[model samples]
Target: MNQESQKSVEYSQYYNLECRVADQVKAKQYNGALESLLNFITLVMHRQYPPGELIGSAKLDRLCEKIGLSFYHEFYGNIVHRDEFCSNDDVSVIICTGLFKSGGTSPLIGDIVRAQGRRKSTILATNSLGSMSGDDLAMSRLGEVNANIIICDKGNLVDRLHWLVQQITRLEPSRIILLNHHQDSVIIAAARPFTEKTKVLFYHHADHNLCLGVHLTGAIHVDIHNVGFCNCRDREQVADNFYVPMTINDLGSDFVRRVFLDKRRLTTCSSANPHKFSNFYFYPYHELIIDRLEARNGFHIHIGVMPESALQHMHHKMLERSIDPSRLVYIPWTPSLWKALIDNSVDLFIGSFPIGGARTAIEVMGAGVPMLMHENYLTRFHSSRDIAYPDHFLWQYPHEFTEVISNITFDDLQAHGMRSRDYYLKYHCTEKIGLEDELNRICDGTSTTRPAPLYPHHPDMLDRSLHFSYLEDMAIGHSIQHDRATHVAPVAAPLTPHQSVSLSLTQKTSKVIGLLTARTYRNALSLIPWLTKR
Candidate 1:
């Protein structure tokens, strides 16, 4: 089939699924409908199925809200757990996530625990959390400080979910903060009925995607930055939406970095996991790096896991362009990504493309290295807009990125680095990232009467059909890779895809869109209304 025909098929598939979901709801089969909704989301997200003119977050959020309400209404008293447990007063907040030993929301979860004291917080690690980060990096211990909570990886999807629900029943925490993988229907299903006693907060870390937790009943969707707050708030969804200033808590280590520049060649560095460096950017991220390096006889230090194949591809591409591939050196996963950048005396740093890495960007900026994020969808996507907008490091087009980085000198680095540091201190510093007030308000059932200012979507924001073929090409087939649609998220430093070293080298894992396993497949069965699907 031609490109247009392909897109039409995807659109039709989604439309039929949407209708099926509605039928299920009308018939009051909420769990089956919820399962169907999840399938619809994955098809849209990874496969880029354009169901309409725009793939907006609110589309499925409204459905999720509807299904969640119906399910909670019918099944609140019938909730079950795998095990019965005694209550523990120590559990005040449950930090739930898929199996990510480091990076992603682990640090933020740690910050939440630190705020209330570690003893009052519990980390409920689900089976979907895969890809362990660096063993030595203290951030892997949820960012320099230590926080070991409960582990809930008992059984398959259903069993683990039941296990999670039972933990909540026993502990009865005052609040349950979700730093979950977005497409986790299990987390959504498990936590749906518990909102009466415990407040559920959807911390919008991965605000760009259509995840399961957006508009559930009794849940408050908290956007960490202004752009996210504006985008989601303008769209209609059932949940109570609010904005909170984003923050990160670390060990508060005092360290100073000095950029040791070798007068002739400019050394640039990027620390985002290689997955963030995909074709989704304006130009391929490797091409962007190569152009910047070739312009001034420069060198670049990359401080994350780069698959052997990607490394060879860059080598071949560099040789074809008549630039030495040696100019681009790939360093294995460094314990300290920002420190590696600073220690290498990098004159300039580039943020990960498409999905910008705000967590690491803040760290590098705080360390006083000049950095900029490649921007396309500003207000539409969850980015570091609270800081990178108006005056800071945002390059909108490829030509602009080339022009800026090509002419940058050490003096430029120092000046821009100083300005970037100023932005960091003014906005994201630890003292500034307090959620206590927001927490208290959430607990008290207080909400802002003010609505968010309307921000129009970027012209290039909606893809007619966004092709994500580059993802599977990299051979990232670890477990739970598709659980949150994480291959497309604002990724943490991907030490290795799903923490499997050799798997990153080979390309054998079946795509999440396979025949029997795909949610899209389940979507087809939901069309029957009373199919009683899992």
Candidate 2:
């Protein structure tokens, strides 16, 4: 089938499924209903669904209430929006976020907290990675600032949200910061009750896709990059859009950027999580790696943890290219990514493909290693290349990426690497010194205006949106299938034969509901109790 027709078929199928889920929500089937709703939103955010049909926060909030979620029940019923900012509370600040999606060891969240949150504070991690060990740097950073940690990744959405709501009330925090994932709405829902007095600030870390809490009123939308700042304000995401430069942790003043004089051979390395490399079709990464190693003298250091499935896939791709994959050395985890690059004496750093790791790019820039990233979409909003999310290091295709690598001279690497570190200091490091003070000013409510003209950094948002559009029908559909399994297993509904509604073999459903298509016919199946599996 043609691509447009195929996409239409998938959309019709999804809409029919969505109608079934709406019925589940009406029946108050919290377990599967909520999960299905979240999965729909996830599909939309991941670009599997239509962009124009993107679900709104108000609609989702209404869904939460209709699904009989205990948290939203309390949020809508018991909570009042207070206009007064309460500074004299038990905890000065409460920061809530999800650490599950990024799939990296980079301390993006911990870096912000360590840099800004100095008063009595608590770090609440909701829906963490699979029983995260103590090696979590974010938690360790909390220790440096004398902050408390709350791990809340257990139980169903209802139970967890209700539990968190109680915690927020008990803590009586002066301010709340939400670094939640696109699909995780528990943090915002829980913090909604205290929006007036507590004054919520949403830190936009993931801005390239659809996200929850953008419709939050009275909350200050804080953007680390100008790309996010413009997108939110232009789109009217929140009433207040605050510009805040992102900050990284200082690994002492001793680590200096060194010069690279080697030209004949290259030693490249990457530390992005497995997700960025999964099913990347925009470029042939495997062939480039094989060719580089084949024509070079040094090995490619694969730092951080990688799934066995990905490793096997890599090997298979290398075999297809008629090259031995011996030079690709995998290092599972390191105490520090910076120290690892320094230890290996790396020549170049490969930024994560399909999704760039901004923090990893900064680290690479700090270590005097030039970065080459796949320009899937610009996640962060900014005009300058210093924050490391720039066109300078970005590569859009396989051959172009290879050419950039081939054309690299020792002079270019040395000059560019030093410039990278200089910009890192100019844009990121100097700001860290006054990060706490800047955060305090924000808490005091200084930033309350939309200061810039409406113009996105990219020439066309198509550069970013097109990536999701390509995978909408096939890749992201399978992705949602896996997500469904993660939320809950689909089992038979507990309806007895007495409650079952079965149509006679001779009775035509088309007669009952005129002009029903194949997909609409599937939508009708949701009403039959005997056929219901959730």
Candidate 3:
């Protein structure tokens, strides 16, 4: 090729070079369409099963090498550019940052949009990578068909609604959905109409007693779904759907699945802070378990934290509790995290209640590690514990945990790991969720993802609040009365009527005497000048 042709070939990155060919075909703007099509093809060409076992050895290695090259290879002659593994958009540029779905091959919403089209499923996520990816995955799919989307950022109220509305308008979606954690009252107060059809799913992640404020607010016009504990006696606490794990199919050959049957240690990872609540308060039950674990010698402990700040916080306590700092693994880096899990011989994983049903749990179980987690009766935000039911495979709180460990031998651990892995494969896998089916239904408008239940103002609300107040007051009153009775001395003798009258008179006299003493001191101070003059 001549220098001009070679130069023109490289310039194709910026300007469309196929214009001449399109002009020959008499098709206008075919180059642009072809570029879009090429982009779609490129998205597929580079797609591999995210770093988990779903992608076989060859593709997994290729993915690792590609990702490795991005980080190791220099850009602009010196700066290494790990972010070059795929094409990126500025708005969607967030896909490459933080503890996102970086570790494994979780699909992004953009990928799904390119892969499947539209989906109809409730996307839920915490502020973590797994959950964020889940949310983005949902949003991307929705963006594909221009369906409505809503978002909730539980504790941290980063106001993105304005930008979100702007995005929704750009996409021309059918509706929008939104939810918030503790700031529902503030959310409702600041509500605006971005579009004609918008819905909110209000939820709380912790302590539900504060939900009295939520329930009291008539402004909760949108659906309200509560998760976590409300009371102790609620046997019907957890929701059936909440505990359902996602099911994934091995995109890899069946031969790979058959070959890997070993038990692995896949600890669920998270920031130990438990949202805004401290680990001490949020995961009281987990603290209790840790205490028991420290009493033993053979048992090793691992705490998963991310962000140097979070890791530091986890470090002091785990050390104080005699847990090794080396065991304090930082955030799981997706496919590597998943790979580490399968490669390590972990027996049982433990979880804290302060956290929502974390994707780490899903990933760990996916790796075949049995889990132990707490199950509170209700949450401070949501009305029902059922709304926040954790994925199955967890031996819920108030468990026979020590007895379980004592009873289960190493062989038992191996067996349980297999069972756990199988459970994840059946339930938590993305492919098994029938994401394609759900997306089609959502796009076609065949399914209505049920809205959270709406609550109306009722007189009973006031009555219940009053009753709760009364109970609190009564308890306080009794405690004070009991303390006085136990610690204060009784009257030395029973009083006659005249003696009681005399005692009352004496009390009044004492008050008069105290007032008189105060007056006398004032007068004496004033007379000092007069006495000096005399």
Report lDDT per candidate. Answer: 0.56, 0.55, 0.32
lDDT of 2 by residue, 1-534 (tens): 677766534456356545765777566554455455555555454332323233245455444444544434534454623433344544655455443323422255555556554457777766511234445544332324556777775676656666776666666676677776665655655666556656678776655455666666567668775546665656644546677666565554456446563456677888855444433333334445665665556678888667686578678867776657786889986656777887887878876554455567666666667777554433332112324623346655555566766777787777777776775665556344466676667768785433223232333355346434544433444445756877765342232121122321111111211112223323323332321111
Candidate No. with top TM-score: 1
Task: Please report the TM-score between candidate 1 and the true structure.
Answer: 0.72
User: Residue 292 in candidate 2 has what lDDT?
Assistant: 63
Pick by TM-score: 1 or 3, better one: 1
Report the alpha-carbon TM-score of model 2 versus the true structure: 0.71
* Residue pairs with clashing backbones, model 2: 226-381, 227-381, 227-382
Q: Score every model by TM-score.
A: 0.72, 0.71, 0.41
- How far residue 417's Cα lies from its native spot in candidate 3, in Å, is 2.6
Question: What is the lDDT for 218 in model 2?
Answer: 62
- Which lDDT tens digits does candidate 1 get at residues 208-251? 55566666666777776666665565554434577665554432
Higher-lDDT candidate of 1 and 2 = 1
Instruction: State candidate 3's TM-score.
Output: 0.41
